[model samples]
Target: MPPEDEPKVEIKLCSENDLVLLNKAIPEPGYHERRFASQQDGKASYLLAWQNGVPVGHLLIKWEGSGPQVNKYLPDTPELNAIGVWPPKNRSKGIGGQLIEKAEGMAKEKGFKQVALAVEIDNSRAKELYEKLGYMDWGHGEYIDEWVEKGDDGEETQHKDPCYYLVKNLE
Candidate 1:
């Protein structure tokens, strides 16, 4: 159980099995698998957000120079690589925001001067959440080239930009 006021949200250090669970929570195809592979082969710090033994969110963090897909928006290093709350279970429960808060605190404790993350400009929910949490809009708009498309067989097709970049600096 977590301390009082923390809402008992259990955050777990990710393992391979948890990868499947995380993938189910996130809509992005192959993202969890890729992150898991990266972590397995010596890579980033990954976290899975769970509530009462049920995985509801996913948070994958990697340094800016280390290779976040949206590194172009980051200033220096250590960006929050990926964050997503399972749609049906998300419901403004503050799960994603709490994970971000935890991420910032962890980064600060590690002597990091700053942390960063890029949200899709079109994702008003994410953008609003970041802004409310004190994440300032820093860089201008930009888009990533590798696009992901849904195929007829429910497969993902890598193509071009799907959304605009909206970076926020963690202070």
Candidate 2:
């Protein structure tokens, strides 16, 4: 049991209605919408962590790997992407760990031998968490991470993040 004041967190597969609530809570423009579409199309799985019936965090599992290195090497491993907990105040509360554990379970259920993720070179905190969870550096060096962010003005901006890959084998 958690402390009385700690919010009870529930993890679930992202639902269509959940997107509306998430958008209202996080307001990331078209981010959730696009991810939801990919989930519907069987290209990915978007998991949402809800606290008090509101989305506080999310993790996206791409059925196929991303980046030249991931594609070239771990082609069959699902890649966990864009994991985060919002409100800034929610950071360092184990929400991210919960999301990652759930994703690993889902991948195991799907018979994947391994799961992988990328951590930005500068994000020492995230890297430490991944390491504590048994994710090891892939030792393939770093690569440029690419993503698109949609603005409130309805325009898309491409981002390039320098990151290294990590991998974990499922039991």
Candidate 3:
């Protein structure tokens, strides 16, 4: 683990512009952080993965609401919505996991009972990382028929991707 006060990395409050950068970082972003931030106060926070003063990763949290998979499950659960480390150059350096831990810490600081998130069931890398860090599955269901799985090589696979609800008990 990096030092508690690593100058190269920071977990800070963000504005609307941060959300735009986060959307660009994640493949299919669903919500912009600023808009969500507009409706929330005292219960939300975002963390940026910075290195050498560049925003290389994003970790945005939100109160319980339905994200992409809400149709398959209710949206009443609070969660850390979008977390992504940008580009090949910025990934696998432990930033993604760090942001999640930071977000979970922040959520606890803000007094949320537990933190929840939705992940594409097929993304084992992300899921494994989450599980290894103590996040657990609460529920899951299949895609909306039009969805198709794509491999790292960009080849389509018949596996219908299901989205899962993941939770981390804060207390």
Candidate 4:
């Protein structure tokens, strides 16, 4: 549960123009900026949850499925990826759930019949959240999740992690 003074959270789709402002709200550097750029380029979409005008939560809507992060097993299924809530203390307060619901609404609006996502096999907390929200583990499969981080010198470093895929029907 959040503290009594925590501000009410507002969830909405992020536009390209909101990138700069949203980046400021995220304490971590580069992460939100990369997501914002992806959204701006139409490669992905995001639902940002703001509390007191600061982004405290976010969920990424990926129409392309998981790509290298997971196999293209469900090619037609849009994915809800990178769901997060800020300031560890702010978790379990319904903010993540609200962001997920908003992402589902967006997916339905886009004409998708269902949605998919991958969770690290060890992340029971996140898996539980998704399960509570109606996502189901179809089964376990291995995939090399990939990511790239840019250094201050403008060089990119790549990394990969293994994960399991999950799915949910929006119908």
Best by TM-score: 2
Model 3, span 38-124: residue lDDT tens: 335744566677666566777667654445555235434566756887776666668888788888776677676677776786788
Q: Encode model 4's per-residue lDDT on 70-98: one tens digit a residue.
A: 44456578778889888788888888888
Model 2, position 162: C-alpha lDDT score: 95
Task: State which candidate, 1 or 4, has the greater lDDT.
Answer: 4
Candidate 3 segments whose C-alpha is farther than 4 A from its true place: 1-7, 16-44, 67-77, 140-161
How do all models score by TM-score?
0.73, 0.92, 0.65, 0.85
Error of 3 at 92 (Å): 1.8
Output the lDDT of residue 171, model 2.
74
lDDT of 4 at 147: 74
The residue-level lDDT of candidate 3 at 38 comes to 38
Mind giving the per-residue lDDT tens digits that candidate 1 earns over 1-171?
133545467777689877666656564666667777766765566777888767777777675433455445454657676687776546477788778878777777777766766666568887788778776654555545454666547787776544444444444
Point out the worst 10-residue segment of candidate 3 by lDDT: 140-149
Runs in model 1 lying further than 4 Å from the true structure: 1-7, 20-29, 65-75, 143-156, 162-171
Q: After superposition, how far is residue 96 of candidate 4 from its true place, in Å?
A: 0.5
**Per-candidate local distance difference test:** 0.66, 0.88, 0.64, 0.79
Clashes of 2: 0
lDDT of 2 by residue, 48-107 (tens): 999988999999999887756677877789999989999889977888888999999999
